[model samples]
Structures are given as structure tokens and as C-alpha cells.
Target: MSATSVPRARRRSAAPPSVDGWELFAPGIRGEGTAARRAWRSRYVRQSAILDAAAAAIAGFAGYYLWFVVFAAYGPRPPLWAVLVFPVVWVPVMLVARAYEERFLWIGVEEYRRVLNAAVLVLALVATVSWGLRLDVARGLVVVTLPLATLLTVSGRLAHRHWLRRARQRGEHLQTTILVGSRETVAALDEQLQRTPEQGYKVIGCCLPSRERSTGADAFNGLPVLGGVTDVVDVVHRFEVDTVAVLPGPEIHGSVLRRLGWQLEDTDAELLLAPAVTDVVGPRVHIRPVAGLPLLHMERPELTGVRRWTKELVDRSAAAMGLLLLSPVLLAIAVAVCLDSRGPVFFRQERVGRCGETFTMLKFRSMVQGAPKLVEDLTRADEGNGVLFKMRHDPRVTRVGRTLRRYSLDELPQLINVLRGDMSLVGPRPPLAKEVEKYGLDMHRRFLVKPGLTGLWQVSGRSDLSWDDSVRIDVRYVENWSLTFDVMILWKTVGAVLRGSGAY
Candidate 1:
């Protein structure tokens, strides 16, 4: 439908029900309209409240059991009043901390952060009460219970989010979204939403900035043009949208946006300002108010610091321990490799490392002897991207090599590379000389950190990723490298390796 066809909202004299201080009712929408919208407004809110209450009860019980039955730390037994008051205190505190708020519940780390904050607040409250009343308390038990309660609470929340994510994949419980920006921005936003429906946004249509005047295009990038920027309230009423995403563009200025916020102040539709800077995660961006204006401060990544040394230490230590612990498996694999083929057990290749340096990357041989010599003959049969040679049914792969490659046992020897500082446990993939030579200026950012045996590339799709996608993810990793991010990648790598979707 064109923007001009959207029905205008009927202005009402009486007030509508407020949502988080904004009016949520579409005045003209009748029948079961306002009541139905009001009911859904608190759907996730109530869900979160019930889940948090259950988490609090479970954590409280576990904490009490651990303190009294297991540890017996509070002089013969803990106080009954203290045990009973925990869940009572915890749940109310969580509610007060805004942990059950709809905005942060299942979307991002903010939910986890709120849970942690509530845990800390509970601990502080208990400590203050104990000291003030001069009550005999077990410090060790308190320590144990605090962390235990926190862990349980966060885990419960994660489980809920997992369930929600699965439901969202089935196209349920999604926010009907409308984009308010230029055609290009709206189209771009739509593509991202489609790629990750688990984000809970379903873009039904879009409103162009030129809605005040006529835009030549009726539909854009497969989405219906609902109306112009000025027609947002009318469009919201027309479609009964749940979210209004305002992308960065010339048509939506500061004054224009303030007016929109005021207009939306009486509607349940959420106003989201999506900045133009894309692919930037939360850790890299900070907002601060200076002289009554919110200023965005972009933090450049910190690649060198004590944290970097800590990561290196962890890499080397883990590599050494892994080699020792898995020696039996390693020996069995080596024997298997040797028995499967006549050539040496190990294969080494020259790969481009950080800053264009060359290093010998080790792996169990996953191909027949003289495989390099056969590459020229099989060039016509290559099913891989032009830069990297790969084929699902490569003739050069031996029977055992295929099995080893399928499960990534062939890459186990790269632990040595990690120990030697030629690679990291998590980073961008090490590129071959031929591939590195094809890199553009932006692609060169991948070299800022050492390559890895398993990284964004390995976990994301391995050999299935296109050259552009490979470069995009690799550069993103290099620009946003952190210890926590590396650890997350390492954890996710286990599942990716198990699935082995893109492995040849």
C-alpha cells in the first residue's frame, strides 16, 4: 500500500492508557483494540516477573541448603528467619532493580547486567542489616550463597531466552516493526532483520522520509511503503505496529525526532533510533551527556595492554596443558594417520601471520602425498572460491584424511602454533599468500592480530563463506578483539566443530 492510502489517527479528548509513560492507545482503533494492546504490553513483563520469582525461590532454597546442611557455618545452624527472608528480599529487590522490565528482558546483555546488579544489591542489603543488628553471621556462607544465587538467576534467564529464541525462529512472539528513514537505510535495515529473526523484529513495511511530499517509488526493496516520516503516527495506527525504528537520515533531524517522540509519547509503539554506524557492538560505544547533548564516544580497540599479555599467557598455558592431557588421543591419531597413508604424519604449510610475517602452520596430513603437485591438474574441478582451494569430493584426499578432516582432528596440531605465538586460540583465520594478495585496504585489518585455528571464520561457516563475508567477519573480529569475545568464540567453536557443516 502507498503512504497516501494510510488512514489518519483520530484525535481524542480523553487520555489513553500510558506505557512506560507513553500513551499506547490508537484513539480511532476500536472494538477489542486498546484492551488487546494493553494486555500484550505487559506480556513479556509478566513472563519475566514470574521467571524471576521462580529463579529467586530456587536460588534461595539452594543457598539455604548449602549454608545450613552442607557448610553448617553459622554456629550449629543458620537462623530460620534469615533463610525465609532471602527469597522475600531477593524477589522484591529484583523487581525494584528493574530486572523484570520488558525493555531489557530477553534482548541483550542489559538483562544479565541487571541481574548481577540485583545480586550485588541483595548482598549489600544483607551485610548492612547484619552489621547494624550485630547478628552473628557466616561470612563464607554469605560469599557462597551470593555467587550461587547470581549464577542460578542468570542461568534461569538464559534458559528463558533460549526458549524465546526457538519460538522466534518459528515466527512467533515477534514485534511488528516499521522503518522510518530513507529508502536505502530502510532496505538495509530490512535485510539485517531477515538475517536474524531471533532479534524479535519483523519488518512488515516502511515509511520513507519524503512522505510529506510524494516519493516516486511505491514499494522499495520488497517492502510496502506505508507513508512518509510525517505520517508515522498515522502509519502506526494503520498497521498497528509494535516498533518504530528511525534510521539515521537527513529527513529525521533532532527537532523532527523530538516532535516524533512527543507524538509517539501517546502510543505504545517503541521508538528506536538506529545510528548509521553499523556492525559496532555495545562495548565499543558509549553515550554521555555533555552540556545537555548526548555525545557518542567511539572507543578504538585496545590490542595491547596487560589484558593482551594475560590472553597470551592463557593461550600458551592452555595449549601446553591440552597437549599433555590429550597425549593418548594425540598418539592414537598419529598412529592412525601413519597407518592410513605412507607419507609423514604431519603436514606443514607456510601461512601469512600478523603483519605479513610467514610461519609454518602444523596439521595432521589430510591429503595424499604430493597433493600440492595435483592442484594444477584439478584447478578446473575446484569448487572453492578463487582464493582458497576446496572441493567436497577432492580426489587428493585419502580415506582416513576425510574422516580426520570431517571432525577437525587434522587441526589438533595447531596447538603447537598457539604455544609458539604463531597463532591465537581465537582470532581471524590465517590466510595463504595467494589469498592475502587479493585483500583490499579494509581487508588488511585482519592482519592486526595473529591468526587462529578456530575463529569467527571457523565457527561461522568455515569454507562456505564468500570472500566478502570472510573479510567482513575477520575485520570485525580484529577491530573488536577482547578477552571475553575470544573466550566466547572459543566456547562456540566446540559446537561449530561438532556440527562440521562446512568442513570438506
Candidate 2:
């Protein structure tokens, strides 16, 4: 049945009750819709305040004891009032820094960044006051307390986030969302929200433009098509939506958006507009108001300069230290590989690196000596996403090889590559020469940075990712490379390796 042929009554029934009736009869429904979200937000904020206060208190007391009691001879004793008042001051400082804002809570790196910024501000204020007043402030106490507080606060937030994620996974705490856009844009936004359920967006339905609405189709991408764009306010009231996400498109322009915002003013649902740009977030994009209009200003990615040099220095230093510290484990893996297989303990394969340069990537030999030769015979059994060859249980894997691969012990030799500048501590996965040969134009963007010992690809399902997904992640990492991002991936890599999923 075509959309035009659909009965008028059926279309009206598909939409919510008339706006006037819903408003007059269901005034209390608005409060019920937002109660859960408001409650969750309040609870989270309260918990965060408690955690921050406790962290500050612990650091303050511990620092005072260590400085005045243990190292009493080295510095003048500070007054006990300073220690007692630290938590009182710290929580307000965090509030001033916007650390506990609802927007920053439970998601994104911004929360952690705000916490760190607040800690720094507190330390600076303390140091300046002490110096200006000529007070006998113990340098040791100042040094230890601020850092300890920051660490404790961040740790607490991380644990809280983990708990929240578990809750979201169980469908306990989630924003009831209604997506408004063209079907294509709605589906895309829905897919992303579905992909990261921990972000806490639970899309209940979508509102499409009248022209975009299908005739007989009542659902799209498994979500019901609630109504047309004009029906958004009624749909929100009827469904008790906590969030209404509008995707940018021709049908929903400035005037239409303004009207929608005005209509939602009396309701509890928050409005969110998703710009067309994708995979570009954080500091790269900023909103600049010019000529009374807010315009998005995107800065070019910084692929080089002081930050890049700093990253290189940190990578080399970390790689050198890691190689030194893990020498025993490396030795053990080497011995095991040698005893279990006739091949050399190390496997060196030519891999494409930064700027399409070639390097010999090293790994503990986890396959038979003649495994490369067997590729043709086993092509039919390839389990990879086409670009790479992967087999969960290959015949070529030695007894010890399976264990090494499972735990990613075989990749330990890549530390030498990192130290040698052939790779980074975290970067795009190094592509094999054959894999690079099959690359399209955009895929070459992966070579913009050095390959990694472990990267977004490594931690994000590794071999289980489709070829397109692998490429997309690599390019995203290249375009948004940051020291913090590298650290995040490295941290997640530890957990991924322990879980041992998708690491054949």
C-alpha cells in the first residue's frame, strides 16, 4: 500500500492523541517522563560530590601526616586548619571547573579533563597563596596532596563509570530518546547509539518528515516511526521521551528547529542537534558565533610539530622501558616458541608503516615454518574480513602458539619496533604489504602515522571487525591522534588482551 492510499484514520491513529487533548488531560505525564532522568542525574551528582570530598580529605590528611609527622625535620609544621579545610575548598573548586556538570558526567574524556583541570587550579591557588603570604607551607605536602587527590578522584570516577556502564547494559539507567530526521539520517544516528549502549541513549522511536514517511511501513530499523516532524512535540509527550535528537538536514532548518525548541520549552525533554559531521569530535571542532549565527569552525588536524615530537619522545622512552621490564616475559615466550615449533622464535614480516614506508614488523613465531606457503591451500577457510587472513583454530598454529596469540604475548617483540621508530606504542594497525596493495584512496590515510603495537583496532574487537570498520577506525585514529587517546587505547588494550576475544 502506498503512503497516499493509507486511510486518514489509520494515519491519525498512528500518531499520538491530539496535542490539545494530551495537554489538557495528561498534565502530570510530563513530570513522570522526566522524573527518572532527573533522579538519576541527582543521584550521580551526589555520589560524585561524596567521592570528590572523600578523595580530597584522604589526600589532605595523608599528606599532612607524611609531611609533618614522618618528615617533620625537613619542613615547618603547617597549621591543622589547612588540612581540615581542604575538602571544603576542593569540592567548590571542582564545581567552578564544571567537573560535576550533567553534560560531562558518565561519558567522554571531558569529565576526566575537567577533574584534572580542577586539581591543577587548586594546586596553583594553594602555591600562590602560600608564596604571597610568606607562609611556611611544606613543599612536600603540596606536591603529594594535589596529585594524590587528582588520582583518587579520577579513579573513583572511573569506577563509577564502569558501574554506570554495567547498569546501562542491563537497561537500568538510560535516556528514553526520540530521533527526528530523514530515515537515512535517523537510521545512521540510531545505529551509532545502538553500537555504544553505554552512552545511555535508548532510542524508542523516530519522527520523520511527512514526505519521507513510508505508506504501509510502521517501523524503521526496528524502531517505530512515531509520526511526522510536526508531531514531534505530541510524540515526546505521549512517549515521555527524555531526549529528542534532531539530525541536521534540509527538511529541518533553523526556523523549523527554533519552532520545535519553543514547543518543547514547557516539556521536560532535552533537545539535541547532531551535526552532519561524523567521527570528528573533541577540541578539533568548536562553535564560533559570527554575525549573530553560531557557525562550526573545524581546525585542521595537527599531524606534526611540538606535540608530535613529544609523542615520539614518550613512545620511544616507554618502549625502551617496556622492553627492559618485560625482558623476562619475552625470554620465556621466545623459549616456549622455540621448543614448540621448528621455526625461528621470531617472525619478521614486511609491513607498511607511516608515509607508506616499509618496516620489518616483529612478532614471536606463532605459526609453522612453512605457514606462508600454506596460505593458498587454506584460502577457502579464511575467517578474516577479506583484507587480512585470520583463522581462529588454524592447523599451522603450534601448541604454544595458540596460548601466545590468545594473550597477545606474540606481539611483545613489537616493543623493539617502537624503540626503533618503526612503530608507536599506540597507532593504526600496521598493514601487510599485500593488504596495502588492495587499499583504496582513503585507506592510505592510515599511513599518516606510525603503526602501533596496539591501537583502536587492537582493543576494538581486533580480527572480528569488518574490513571497512577496521579502515574507518584506523583513519579516525590518524585524524584525531592525541597522547591522551594513545593512553586510553593502551589502557583498554590490557583488558582486551586479558579477555582474549577476537584475537586469533
Best by lDDT: 2
User: Which digits, one per residue and each the tens of the lDDT, describe model 2 over residues 131-169?
Assistant: 899887777888888899999999999999999999989
| Model 1: per-residue Cα lDDT over 132-217, one tens digit each | 99877777667776787778778878888888888879766667778899877886677667657788786666788774337465
TM-score against truth, every candidate = 0.86, 0.88
Worst 10 contiguous positions by lDDT, candidate 2: 3-12
Candidate 1 Cα errors over 4 Å, as ranges: 1-43, 72-74, 79-82, 209-215, 376-386
- The Cα RMSD in angstroms, rounded to one decimal, for candidate 2 relative to the true structure is 6.7
On the 0 to 100 scale, the lDDT of residue 304 in model 1 is 85
Candidate 1: residue 190 lDDT (0-100):
75
lDDT of 2 at 406: 92
